[model samples]
Target chain A: MTAPLLRIENLSVEFGPRANPIRVVDDVSFEIEAGGSVGVVGESGSGKSMTSLSILRLVPEPPGRISGGRILFDGADLLALPRNQMPDIRGRDVAMIFQEPMSSLNPVMTIGDQIGEAILLHQDLNSAQRRKRVLELLRLVGIPDPAGRIDAYPHQFSGGMRQRVMIAMAVACNPRLLIADEPTTALDVTIQAQVLALLKDVRQRLGTAILLISHDLGIIADSCERVVVMYAGRVVEEGDVRSIFRNPAHPYTRALLKSIPRLDDERDRLYQIPGSVPLAGSVTQGCAFRARCPLRVETCAVDRPPLFAFGPSHKAACWVTAEAAQARSAAEASP
Target chain B: MARYIFWRLADSIPTVLLVLTLVFIAMRILPGDPAIAALGDNALPDQIAVFREKMGLNVPLWRQYLNFLHGVVTLDLGRSLISNTPVVNLLAHHLPYTIELTIAATLIGVTAGIPMGVLAATHRNRPADSAVRLYSLVGYAIPDFYLGALLLIVFSLNLGWFPINGGGDDFPSRMYHIVLPALTLAFLKSAFMGKLARTSLLEVFGKDYVRTARAKGAREGRVIYRHALRNAMLPLTTGLGMSLLATLSGSVAVELVFNRPGIGTLLISGISERDYAVIQGGVIVFALFVVVVNLMIDLLYIVVDPRIRVQ
Candidate 1:
């Protein structure tokens, strides 16, 4: 619709020597509508984190670089924005909370000073106003006794409470998009639920779109309306969460869903995908998942599959599955 | 915090006593007799005996040690055997010159080193970083005494910019004489500090909190100086404490090369003359200096790093 809040077009992140660099994130494209939630689910090294980092242009250079990309946020191409002006957009328009709540907050700084820093950067609030705002933010994030605990350091807070402080800092400026890279992966299960709920609540209250990255499909399913499934630096499947879960088109998506442990009576051995996802840049000229896909054909090895549409908004990058869907659709049209 | 300081001060008593004991033993165990060194070699046996008894050396080993400890506690360090001046007076005269030299060198080192370190870390792998690293390497490799000689030759002999020897009289002349020696020491200390700062800053830069600082859109300068530098300073401060002790010891050689009238010269002359009270007093002062410095560093830890602060 009306120019999705954030659009990533042909984004590619590479590392290593320039002559034969390793591409960590290759041709990833996604969109997040304003006030919407999207999840990127992938195994470690699947480029999901890199893709998210590229959105903010925060990827470590030298070793890591955004080799090619257009990150259009609102109407501006964030990739093309002047380096000096990036700070204006970062905490103000788009903020991020990392996976590590333990080490993410500055150890030497008090929680009030840290959360207040985010406000201080973008908002032109004086120190008193900033302190008042920080206290409010702390209360909003469910931190008890915002007054007494404001001066407490990161070490004094529990893991869950620290994450809440991080959340408070992230939302200090009311960013339009919040990129959470495995925000709950380091938390206890109960804490994870609480954090996820807090994130959802923050989104509802602030109307900030969320780009959630995680290796947990269940988390994606529960938190996201739409999901992008990435494998070996490429999106293998993307669609509304319901359709993708009900009728997963990509073989990797099917494998991921199958691997989820069920509470009901089931097989003695837990299901596992047959092979590990290939290392980024390891698969050069083929469908990245062809080596592990059970339904892979000759064409899958010679040529990479593009995202082929199966429905109005659902797409899958799989030679066999997309071709089968196309032929079935053609037969139905002929009838 | 006061309790921590009190305990820290109390903790140094044992260390100070251990140093005093070691000094006492070293004076006794070493070969030359204080009687012969203080008096003349041709002195009669009766005269030597009188000198030994006068100096309390005729007492038993345990008794001498107890007397030495008692004198130290009561601020009664004995007179220098050669100069016949009170050990406190000698220390009072020479200690200020050493302190002045040390403070000057330290000021130069910290001011030069930290900024170079920050620059090198921020521009890592660039020409600036390589240049700073090279400077640090050279600084570490070259001995301060040799560097002092070279500086004297170049700046004093060739350039005629500074005097070759002697601690100068008056504030301005003292500052002028200090420049070369301070530079020689500062070169090495700054190199040490720069290397430490660069390493510490580099490590802090990679920390998750630093990345978080960046994501919050803090300007580069703010991220580096405010966030990364403060975190990096804890290790640097510890390193600084170590380096300060090193500089203290290093000053002995530099002082000899420069021929400045400092505690180093006093100690050297004391050893040659076997001035037991002078040597013992000087060694105790050094030991106490070390204790106070280490104590200050621990207290500094509380100020710089909140994690180490007493709850």
Candidate 2:
């Protein structure tokens, strides 16, 4: 019944001078249904965070700029919003969680005070109501002894707990969307699971659409319903969680899937994606992943591929996907 | 935090003592008899010797040191050889002027430098940032004395905007005179502070917390002053502390250019006449003031930021 919460179209971000901009987000588009979860998976410098930052208009300054983009949130053009209106929108309609929990929360302020600060900024809650809501938010985030711990500083918290505090602050105003940018990367595996579970629970309770960003496939698998794969600042593949896991089309996407170590894998060796994420400034012609792709062909080196649909919900950008699939079948049949 | 303060205070005591000791040894060991220097080139050797004995110059080095230590302990600064009055009295009269000048300069330096630094960092690599950098560079190039003279000529002599020299008989006029000297002193120090603030702010702006603040939707102004600027001020705090002492202690040049009766001028005239009491008094007082100012700066570290106090 509710319209899709967000729709991004042809979003390209560039960092560096306008004369020769280093493109980081290249015409990436996707949609998140209301209360839906989308996982943006990629490695460091893969522009996952940049995508989220572009959505929030939080890209690092001067050299970095949104060169071209149209971000539609519930049919409203986000990029078209005036600069003065952004503060009113942020924390009211949307909020974000950062990667480093230890530093994300202001160390100098009490957890209670930090949460109250956001509420005060975005909501019309008075002092007493603010205090009550802060405690409620803390409790909602599963912080034990909420009353006692409200006055504690960020330094007093463990990594997992600090992240919970960050979530509480982000969710203080019950925003419609919450972007978690590598929200649990720094935590241990167990803590990561806990954090992911907490996020899942929060989304269920508040009906908040989550845009989860992480490099780990396991994190994406557990925390997201749809997956968007980024490479060299472009979406190489995107699909529903089921289709993406079962059959990935892009070489980069397939390579990424194979790179994840499995407990029941062959005894020979763990597969690697072979090459690094291309340096953002150096990608000049054709596909940025062409240099390392296994499905390389003449077209791969000469012309960049556009996204082609494999299924209604799945799409990929690869020059020789058809040939690569036929060749893969021939090799499998020969073996 | 209390322990940190106690240790910082403890560390400063020896610094004060060592400086006074150096001042004592350096003044006494220099190859010139105060008696001859005070009495003039034509004075008889016997007359100089009598003056030395009367002034306790005949005592051994260790004994004189003991006497000096005793005087310091008892807070007895003794008489000014040049003024023929208590060194404490002379210092009390002139010290206020220098202190006022130093405070004014420091206030100017901090206010101007901090904002300039913030602006430079925010608009880094742009014309505004470059302009601030250029200003500090120019500040560095011009000598304080030359700047002081130029200011006097332009603002005082030609413009008739202020009295050319001295605080004068009235408190307000004296304060007005101090303004030019303070501005000259601040101009030099502020460039350094401004550059430090800018570079430091830029660095802090790169920090993860700053990124976090931006993501949290803090306004640009809030992200800068409230978030990035506070952390950047840590380094400035340390540098400014030491500079405060240097500016206050080195008021001699500007004071001379402006005919202000500050401790620097007092010390210069005292040394010229071999006025040992004035020299001792000036050195000890200046040393103690430096020590105390540094201590206050350390204490201020916790106040400018709550995180430091938390640590």
Candidate 3:
């Protein structure tokens, strides 16, 4: 089997002083295959975005530090790479798109200049060639009048168009992976669909692996083949998108699935989880989701459940799921 | 852009007129009469009366105001009450010295202060940052005259590296003699510029575009100079404009300490002698200089950031 493009092992990110650190991302592990897509879904502060930022080593320092992690890309440990060498790898092999499109772009720079910056950094293109590539990238993003809009400033573009320019910049160097952190959260519903469609088109055309971080399950389901569900900085469930959505193994994942407002369901009100995700570093023991988990067992308070496989590509970090899987496997083996 | 400049100039007519009127009234309202001041207190009452009548002091206040306004409109500033020299000629003679000192101070302030601010902001919370903050604080706290005197005592009196009096005769010598006064003004103003640059750069660094620049595989140096610095320049430009005005007016204190024959020194002497025409001309010219600098700053905004041009 071919090696996965990007593999993360026991990654942890901490905030504040080392002595009394707040673990924002705790022992999370996942992989993205070459030219494939993976979605990380969770509520705010669930470490979904932190995990993406950790991949790029872009987490704000002094306050944020990658305490423990092995980020292996192309069979090499990225964490062990020298700081000087990281810049070459950043826009060349991986690029990131941030939320808040209005603020993401440089206000003073022309769109053409901003897009050309990445090409100038990573590619050996001359000024003329860079200009051509910038125009092409702008055109590729479906921007109207790419030639005219090239000289336009950030404020000249609407929210969705600015996001498109951001996409153009991200894909300027033709990176292997694109880490999009809530790319559509700042856009309206219709514009969100358009941006998502643009992302899909970009991925398909460029054959770039996507590590999509978002809170919207529908977006994840629509865009990804596999999904990792995070709860309180830990991955509570990981499985193929269909399996996770069809049969969520972890109670937290199940609750999250239930909370989504359905057009078909004749409910008076939307379902809501009982409690919010615990603040970082606040929960030091037991299951992080037990406080809000409806099917949490007494053992959940005593010991943290390791991820147990339920099916070929499905795993959940819940004692109930683990025990049921164990009993089912035993019964099947006896028959 | 041309139309905007035209409108700005047209709008400044009222401001200039107001300044002229205020200066005229202020000169008259002062305790000492100009003729008396020119003639000295030892003069006999008959001699004082003859001097006052000759200087047109015996005219009605409204008529005198109208005469001054008419003289201003005709580009005639009359004569200095003490020396009897044309006020325009006096201004022309000393204006160069003040302009040279102000330009030198401004150059030093921008060149030194901006770099210091960038360094302090980039190395934030480090010893360098603390040192810059302390420097700016001291710069803001200390008066220019006090600092100028200290510089003179150290550089001129003690070291004897620079001359202690009036602007030198030759251009090279003038440049040399102006150094201490310029340094005094520059040091005070640069501290202000440095503080402004640091705060503006720090704020720009927090902006999302700076992060985007980093994500683009650009080097840290490129990220700061190319992406962050230009955005930071907007506020710095305003600070620089204000600094120009401060240096121009604030030079009065430095000129007194250094004994330079600049417009500031002339203004001080004019006030002492109660030279009404000289006072009126100097104040009007200084006000015009400020208005022009502000207009230039507005024009500079369009060049620095094209967004302003579109607006």
Instruction: In model 2, state the lDDT of residue B163.
Output: 82
Clashing pairs in 3: none
Fill in the DockQ of model 3.
Answer: 0.77
Q: Itemize residue pairs with steric clashes in candidate 2.
A: A16-A63, B167-B174
TM-score of each: 0.98, 0.92, 0.96
Chain A of candidate 1 gets a TM-score of: 0.98
lDDT tens string, model 1, B153-190? 99999999999998999999999989998999999999
Ranking according to TM-score, highest score first: 1, 3, 2
Q: What fraction of the real A-B contacts shows up in model 3?
A: 0.68
TM-score on B-chain, cand. 3: 0.91
How many residue pairs clash in model 1? 0
Which lDDT value does model 3 have at B228? 90
Q: Per-residue alpha-carbon lDDT of model 3 for B119-171, expressed as tens digits?
A: 99999999999999999999889999999899889988999998988899899
| Higher-ranked by TM-score: 1 or 3 | 1
Q: State the TM-score for model 2.
A: 0.92
Task: Give candidate 1's error at residue A148 in angstroms.
Answer: 1.0
In candidate 3, what are the lDDT values of residues A174-242, reduced to their tens digit? 999999999999999999999999999999999999989999999999999999999889999999999
